[model samples]
Target: MLDLTKLSQQMQGMSQHINREAEASRKRIEIALNLMEQAKLNSDNLMQKHEEFKQRIIFKPATPLEPLNHYPYIVEPPLAHTVFATDGSQIAPSAHEIAYCYLINVGRVILHYGQSRHPILDSVPEIYYRPEDLYLSRQWGIKTEEWMGYRRSVSEAIILAESGQQLLEISPNQQLNIPTLALVDGSLVYWFLEQLPSEARDLILQPILQSWEQLRLANIPLMGYVSASRSSESLSFLRLQACTFEEPNCLKYCPGTGGMSATGTEKKAPCQVCDPLRDTVLWESQLKPGQRSPFWRSNSSILDLYDHHQIYFCYVNVGMEIARLEVPAWVVENSEQLELALGMVIAQVQKGYGYPVVLAEAHNQAVVKGGDRSRFFAMLEQQMIKAGLRNVGISYKEARKRGSIA
Candidate 1:
């Protein structure tokens, strides 16, 4: 009787284990089936697009079209040597509305432009947008950070950064000088410019390249301000490699990206292999010129005498690379500098525009779209107004730095 009791307990345990195993196996199969279905759907979509393209070619196949691009002509050296930064931004599903703007500075006056224009704002559905709910988001800006969908993050980040640049261009009066340095909020490399449609891409490159031609002829100085948005974010990525992941390829620390090339007025497509970081500072490089070592990982890009200060965008042109670097940590402390710059810009804008604060709203209004943008807009507005600014409105959408996009 005792042996029979022990055998009965063993049998019950075995049966429970088998049942659990079967359930686990069933789940795996379900997952596999779902993935297969998704793959099939993607394949079908590609086929349909291919067929459509084929039809266009069959009917419209004609001559090879050569692109004719013209650069603007400027006769004289800009009144005051200046800097102009042009930028563009895009949302996930709403590719139709890529934000394009420019910032101009003749080494004195800050030219800011901000307008919400929808270019190539497509109502296309992304694979991730739930089919049932996609109709609600068709025309609305679609964005969400996904690990597997990292490019979405990149695309949106670039879009927000671009809007900030455009905010600089939308001067109420719209008159700017040449020989300006454009302090773009991102990298100096236009490799990613090609990611945009041809016309959309030109909206960004045309002005700067035109200025480049004019400046080159006039022998003037006009570079861009390209810097990382937040220093902490940059630090997080660095620490991930330095303390967390210990990623390889870390070489000597450099102040700027070495060996920059002069991109012509004709914009080209973005190179896939190009590094995603800002072009202002060579994050991973040795200080020596012509060394050509691998990328570096450190906060030594442009540390001020005290330390790396980010609030004030630092302009460092080492060899061919001209970059604008911001130390977010530093920006938090010395906000007065940012306020001073905005104050100067607002004053300049008001000199020509009707009102100061009202003019600033065109760009500032759009900053708050979905939720509480009051704290943010108020802070920026207060900063500008406190600086005795001229009152040129700003699009809050364009002003929110990286990671601030909704």
Candidate 2:
């Protein structure tokens, strides 16, 4: 339950905080504006900033491609094209069940756009009840869900990769000239891997990497599109370049400069000078319809493990939302593939009213409704009963809710 009054008060405080720091944030933006144009040509400046932080920086926001610029390059997708999108919905482990169980539903959508629109949609639900799947620790001491949700995420990526392969076989008679784009619904680099144990990460990330390899080997273009993204990796780079601090990683030692308070009386916290704007918000004014920002490589520490699969991103305004799109290094290096992917994504967004039609369809197919969850558990209960198992009833609290209504 939420305390409405307290939450309301916090919102007021947040507004005041923004007001207090507005001027300083504006100044920081001005400083960043000066560097934005020269960010690429003056690589020495960024390099010096990077050298200052050295090993202290957790994630480095270096651009392996071109630097920040406002040049809007709109790539019109091929007149006849096919787009494939995959998304996943999961049922987390619940305590009201007889057995420790979970379920993952992966939804896939393949759409042919141009003269005639033909859409193929499918969903596959995977159920897990094995001891290994339910527990993480050696002695079954800790539940897998307790640690993190990486298992489901990894599974989703693997399934998404498989779906991409299936898209290739969709129509053997189709012309080879028609561009095909494979898309997933998140960042290409799995940051959650860093949270898991080293051994667990190795075991899980392997399949995801293999999926990327599969797509690459088959000459399929893949992308990860995040709509209205809150990621600030690009802003972090701006901070590094805009900071007045001569030393590397001043955020570590300088507690005096974080986020601003509602009142200007207190010292600001670290990284507050950047004004806390996400990369998307920062670029909303810069990009026009169908134009995408320059590629920014993700500096996440987890990205180092990707080897050849490191991720790069660009912001695209598809006449609706400023979306962040991520792709592997291979995709970025290939000029033709990048242009086709960007064009197809923009086209999809326009067709779906600010979102990709295929992705939205995949999401619809993947979603698990509340009634569906209830029925699933009910089915499990019946199976338990039929197997002559006792003590398989739900918790008393759940039972009371089932019997009571507001």
Candidate 3:
């Protein structure tokens, strides 16, 4: 039944591709290593130069990013604190299924270290079949699975914020003062919403802003943790510092060729002085266990949509791996809150072997396994039959497989 020879051939081809990619990546990393060595020698000069480029980029909006300083420090968390984490998973609408429906399951976990004897856990499942939820506006011009995924992610984040808000208000008999750190599994900024029309985007933002306000009022620090992040925001800044041409000079010295003769025109400057590598690559070796880099604010246009909740981020070494942590402007402004959050994140990662334990549990709780998904559809079909509704049978191919497998 299996083509072992063909499978072996395919594996050999994939191995070749992996080797090629590895070589290319090595070359790219070498470029970054050279720039970093240069940065150490001229740190003060680069710092002042970065400010000049940042100012000049405002007037000339076409060019890319600004470099920021990388300052690393270690933070020791308080002995007693509570970590509330929430994660979500979803089953998308399928055509072969009888009903046009989608399900989102959110898992929330509360872990109180040095304050409580046991962890608390909960889960909420939401099923959507409303007309508005099933379809998108015609003007949006897309009905792809990616759009549904984005909607699900936004819903998950809102629910997590709400759960965090509720937890902050809880009053227990063991009334010792303990710091609370609320965490979500992804970025705080809804970057995907930038593609939608202003009106549609505003509608989605309304509930998220309300949820954020609840957490803000409760004074709980919320963080979005991304492991093995590929974001190059910091690298983009480094490129600006490494580039030979100043922002203002790009107009004259780096003007396009426009088919002009080389004899009369100024030579085009080299566009990129350093290879495009992720910010983590530079910090992977630099950040020690429990240490974190300084904050770097994103200049993404999507950030403008979030007036007060704009995002700022940093990288931390959690004893096992490097991770990116994103926080809102509110967290960045409060020094005590920021320090507490950083410490807790590091502590959680150390406890969980490079990942947060609460988040891992939340994910396990939320995940919809293959067996569970099959059972869900079977149950739905049975309900439809009981209600005297005609069932749209599953695809013949699926039916055949199900009949033969068992």
Candidate 4:
């Protein structure tokens, strides 16, 4: 059991440290805000600086598409539109379980506003027990939880695309002109693929690329909504503005060294003024509710593999918190579709009280509670017994945890 009494006693000291950190963070935010103003004043030259130093910068900074200080108010949503969202959950394969299998459940939701059609809400669950599904390579090792998470993200996007296509096929002829927005739960940029080998990354990315292509072909705007996002792409741009050097070279004039060495050799040090700030810190006060920041193209190397589907992102104030919305280049290029997507997202947040209703519903449909997990194992055990498996049982550790003697 947790020692609440000890934890309570320690809270006093912890609170003091937290306060000190908070004060330091406040100072950093003030400096960052000043740098942001500088960035806005030098907005025209900012992109040139980015282009000059992008190859050498150690961190990922977003490429700005509009002026840095631009914050546009929300546009009115279309009178009649549909929002489709998909989310996924997975049960990781465990060695201590009675059965060596995993499951992926994708929940899909379709909400139509100003239309008589009923909302669509459902989940599709699939089980995987075959060796091919469980292992990427027997010599390398069984697929890890991280791999499973990437797979789940891919599955969510694919389902969202399929749902959008189905909506287009079934909609009435008049409703065809009405806008549709497809949303997924998180970042569209597959940053996780950066660590995997080319072959392994291709295996996960090709399917997601195909899904994005399908959405693009159907002229459906697909987006990923991240709540309370900690992304720093915007902050990174401001950091570049904070650099005192005319040409910022992270390696030649490293942040770790504070500057070049006495012999003109390169060393590195963190930026004392900007290192502690996040993009949200600078925008939380600047952007009013229903306002969104300017768009920026993600500089992730993974997007190099995206082919025609490069990703762009912007920050939005959703009343409760700042959210990051990522979309493909096609969505950003089409002014009408982009506005429709932003308006619908803000409207959804209002309807759901600070969160997107369709996404929330999809999550509700995807979540796997503890009781459901227990029931799933029970059913599996019964089926195995019926199949004449004599030695089917959970490992000792699992049994001990399930029924602790203490």
lDDT of 3 at 213: 72
Error of 2 at 380 (Å): 1.9
After superposing candidate 3, which stretches have Cα over 4 Å from the reference?
Answer: 1-4, 10-27, 37-70, 172-176, 248-271, 404-406
**Model 1, 236-307: lDDT tens per residue?**
222111211122211222112233447533321121112223322322232332112111122222222212
Q: All candidates' TM-scores?
A: 0.22, 0.85, 0.83, 0.93
Top model by TM-score, which number?
4
Model 1 residue runs over 4 Å out of place are 1-180, 195-208, 215-220, 229-406
Highest lDDT against the true fold, candidate: 4
lDDT of 2 by residue, 304-406 (tens): 8889988999888888888989999899889888888899988888888888988999999889999988888889889989999988887788778778876
Residue lDDT tens for model 3, 1-406 = 8999988977877978989878877786777767666765665665566556654442111112123244557587888888887787888887766777888888888888886557878778887777677776445765635556666666766776776655655663342257788888877767678788887787677777777777787788889999888777766655544667644345555565233465875433353433445778777867777667768677777777788987888888876777889988899899889998998888888788879998998898888999978887788889888888874568777678768965
Show how many residue pairs clash in every candidate, following the order shown. Answer: 60, 7, 0, 5
Off by over 4 Å in 2: 1-28, 37-41, 48-53, 56-59, 115-117, 137-143, 146-148, 173-175, 243-272
Candidate 3 has a TM-score of 0.83
Sorted on lDDT, best first, the list reads 4, 2, 3, 1
For candidate 3, the lDDT comes to 0.72
- State the lDDT at 306 in candidate 1: 19
Off by over 4 Å in 4: 137-143, 172-175, 255-272
Task: Flag clash pairs in model 4.
Answer: 255-269, 256-268, 256-269, 257-268, 257-269
